[model samples]
Target: MSCFEVVDPLFGAYVLGNAPVKQIATGFDWVEGPVWFGDAGCLLFSDIPNNRILRWSPSAGISIFREPSNFANGNTRDKQGRLLTCEHGTRRVTRTELDGSVTVIADGYGGRRLNSPNDVVVKSDGSIWFSDPHYGIMTDYEGFRAEQELPCHVYRVDPSGEIKAVLTDFAGPNGLAFSPDETRLYVADTGRMFGSDPQHIRVFDVALGGRLSGGEVFCTISPGCADGFRVDSEGNLWSSAADGVHCIAPDGHLMGKILVPELVSNLCFGGRAKHQLFIAATTSIYGITLNRRGAQTP
Candidate 1:
């Protein structure tokens, strides 16, 4: 095991430095999707098989934020600081209001139900974006096995409540993140439910009107799949993979790796200063302090 080090200055040589894979908490059955609630001073993550959302904090440790979560997967916060979530069981994107009420955002497109909303993100302008794949519907473990009513596609929900398909024809879209400037989008193509030959992250330029254009390959992972990811203020991409967490530079180059004991599912930045990286791995949750804070939330 390696000792954890705090790499200061975002561009330092040790930014992607390895550290001991300390297991903060365990006993989760298939953990996925994580987001920091700085205002609440807690970290929220999904326990898919348990159908609940778990909360962790420096003081509270672990607690149940919500039960019967409808197999929520990915989570993020909107510009108004509301919690946006993708629920696989319900095949819908929902927003949790400050008063604790859940509002359904989008569950259908073009008169058909979504396959299964996998991961989600909120743009600075208050639009919601998410990936729809059938992983949840095809399995009885993560969520209820249901027949998919629509093809898998990445969808965008405008601020005006209009839902539209942004990208089609991906094998299996897993996770996505926006560039620091919100001018680019990075989406992970996990591909065909564990099939070979198409597991990579694709980058798309966000047009002036927020439409995606100039789709192109961003970078490919080696011996692992890029599941979910986030970007830093310096434009570096931090993503989860089968092996661990891989940090990629803005120029689409591999920089370093943070080895965890399990296949990482998702991660987010938190802490009093928002410099701590909290990861929800397959079976446990781990965290490390970084010298620099993450980029401002989008």
Candidate 2:
């Protein structure tokens, strides 16, 4: 018996008129940072408070990928198919090599430790960008609290291992994704701690050579705020909100909702055809099969 029931008749609005089925993967504390591994035919996500990373597959059910994960929060795959993770416990963004070694990608800027690496994304040109907010460090549940030496900022790491602060004044930048064409970057100002702008998603024009400019308010998710999200092949943004999974079209129009019982934290597109959307909600993991494919990784 499936744990999900399609409450709305328009659940397939984002799929061009095709219905989808939702599957649930229960048992977790706080899940976030979901990334699809197409070659492995599985999905990996973080259980932040549990301090471990878990894997899910159609054939294998669920398993632990890594324990004592340093409170990893956000995850993605690089061009080389290596896992890129943001570790709140260690206060660093790291990359897992193919041979099982970990490389510290970024931990500090200007000789100061990062507040906490929350979410990350890799661009087409191989540049890595992430949001660093203090939410992870402010509480002991996620990571050890150390006095923050620098202000919260969003950073971009070049292919050469150099880190540069891109944006510095977000109340709290949580989840982020790039448009399919790689022309725009959408950031979720979750405002998880401070109720600054509770329902805003900001869009920025990706300037040449891995720079961002022309920041503008993309859309306001009424009734809920945007959490972690991903973009599909058709340029639709799939994001988590208070009500459920909201799909916003390329022109910033609300397409429909995949309502979940809990607050969704992050999501990724997986399955053989890349049409399966796996969501990491508050305490459980849920997935749905979509008719459209997700944006292929660059």
Candidate 3:
């Protein structure tokens, strides 16, 4: 069966279905947050329900990166190469230092405990962005169920140690990413999973003072919703949808899709030249070669 459904000619340039989809590993409860470490030649991802982080490399295959990872949900590397992780069980974002020490990045705002940091991304400006949703706290499967004190919001943590609630108008803020040029921000609002409304990716303009404006629905994923995504160098978005991965153009058009056997939760660009698309699906990690390169961090 074909893996790609090209809706536009531009999508054809990126979808190379001739390259077979490879399964790197399996047997996880639920996998998400795939980040490629070129320097280490390994990929790290979260098995949220398992409450651990797993590592996979071409030479070593699969091993435990971190056991009892506080039910970590999402992770990304900073420009300085530190691992920034969002912990659902702890309801905080943490940084793993080069020396292997973990530091707390953000856990609470204004003395009120955060709901749960879901997905995280580092901006070129040295600011950290993350989504706060109650998914982790809503069930005992992923994390401890507790009373939520903060509303669902996306936060920006600056280098100077200031945390700002950038966006607070969503019922559930799930995944977040910046455009290739860092001029735009795309965040997934997955409220539709619990209700009947708000199930699209919202795009916003990144302003001069680290503020956001122009909150508009960029596109809607049918048969599912966008959970996490990354942008190609050309500004095309590869989002994790229920069916598989949906490729959305910069202009909010459904370009194409890569159908995985399992539902995808998140993805990132990896490999030597950064064209390899690593997907975190329900129970396995899948990858395929793509024609476009992912927009790398500075």
Candidate 4:
């Protein structure tokens, strides 16, 4: 079967090839958090079960970026291009400095430890946002199992070192991303991982000081959950699915699906122009060049 499924006529415009899902690397125990570093000309992502982070590029191929990554799950670059990571084992969020040092960003709240930071994004104002779920603490393969100290919620950490629980109505919040203009925030509820709940994405209005409002259902994925995704410059959400990558329009319409051979775990836009879409599926990494640029495009 063909790898591309163009539901809407416009969907074909974004896909550059009939079978563009090329396997760039393999031999992983479940890959996630594919983020591009244009300045470095490589892509960095997590191997959750392996407890390491891997780097891939045309020149260098695949190599160990960090072993014992604290069972890192998600990653994104700050405004200054520093790496922001969500560590499951450590049960905290951290930042990789330019000088090769690690800075602990957020590890706890109210004097109690966080469950496990699943995904993270950095706003233009330097505020850090992430989804906290209990997945990391529920399994020892990805992270050490531990008792839950907090309910699942989304958080925002400001430059002043204050953490605020912005949303608390999810069973298990998984992935999150911001619109290109940063006017909207999109979060996914992968309830299947924790309990029997709908697998859908929610949208919210970004208020002043990075506050969130107007929580509403954005889209629903059938037969699978939205694990991780990224927004394009035009606001389309490219989300991971059981089949592959599903492209949903800003209006919450399912526009297309990139039919990857394996289940897609997460994806990100990278390359020098930030137009290449990288897919981190179950045990391998797939990538393709796209006509669209990511929200973090330089």
Say which candidate scores most in lDDT.
3
User: Residue by residue across 178-273, what tens digits does model 1's lDDT show?
Assistant: 998899999998887656758899999997667889768899876587888888777888888777787788878877677777888888888787
Write the residue-wise lDDT of candidate 4 on 170-259 in tens digits.
989899998988999999999735478877899999988987788799998765789999999899999999999999999999999988
> Cα RMSDs of all predictions?
2.5, 2.8, 1.0, 1.2
Per-model TM-score versus the true fold: 0.94, 0.93, 0.98, 0.97
Better of 1 and 3 by lDDT: 3
Error of 3 at 120 (Å): 0.7
Deviation from native of the Cα of residue 57 in model 4, angstroms: 1.0
- lDDT per residue as tens, model 2, 44-105: 99999999999988899899999999999999999999999999999999999999999999
Query: Which model scores highest in TM-score?
Result: 3
lDDT by residue for model 3 over 129-165, one digit each (tens)?
A: 9999888988899989998999999999999989999
lDDT of 1 at 207: 76
Using TM-score as the yardstick, the better of models 1 and 4 is 4
**Clash pairs for candidate 2:** none
- The true-structure Cα RMSD of candidate 4 reads 1.2
